[model samples]
Target: MKKLLIIAVMALSFGTYAQVDPTFEKEGDKVKATYFHANGEIAQQGYFLNEKLEGEWKMFNENGDKIAMGNYENGIKTGKWLFWEGDVQKEVNFDNNRIASVNNAKTKSPVVIN
Candidate 1:
């Protein structure tokens, strides 16, 4: 029906612009940030120092599944980061904010297509 079509169009339009601001909380010397997706689900969670990204960060998909996790020092990437890709996991090492080495390992995990 025409009414059904109009309602569907409106829903899609709203979804296209469904942005929500991230919430921040103070924790000791760092500010904890929780970023959300359009559906109000947590997209990423991390800490910030001096208004810059600091410490460990975890990224999730819309379904609340972790897709990536890593660490940062004074906003610079550092340490090990894990990323899920299909049935494999990419383990990356960082030094000086750059890739130091990469190793691929097999794992059964849920994957989200962006």
Candidate 2:
């Protein structure tokens, strides 16, 4: 019906603008991304290049606190990375572009607090 056609056109137009251009390699490749909490205190953003995460990435908690930060090389996590959950600070090691180990701060009594 004519009404159905109109609705379909409207939907298609909206979808086209709602998505980010994730395909940065070849021209005219469709790519999409979603950003969280744009106006809220906490904001998180990420992107997909050619449908793969191929750059720096960041994440934050609802309270506007940084939760994690790292990079993606060809969609694989690589290089130094840091992760924070609540009050805990963790340092992660990577090898061959993969996570090797994670080190967290140790808690100690007053006598050994360093």
Between which residue pairs do clashes occur in model 1? none
* Best prediction by TM-score: 1
CA lDDT of each prediction against the hidden true structure: 0.92, 0.66
Give TM per candidate: 0.80, 0.53
Clashes of each: 0, 0
Scored against the true structure, residue 26 in model 2 reaches a CA lDDT of: 42
Cα shift from native, residue 23, model 1 (Å): 0.3
Query: What is the alpha-carbon lDDT for the whole of candidate 1?
Result: 0.92
Alpha carbon lDDT at 4, candidate 1? 100
The digit string of per-residue lDDT tens for model 2 on 1-114 reads 999999999999886555333222243442334344533443445556767775667777757788887877667888777888766778787776778998895542366656
State the TM-score for model 2: 0.53
Using alpha carbons, what is the TM-score of model 1?
0.80
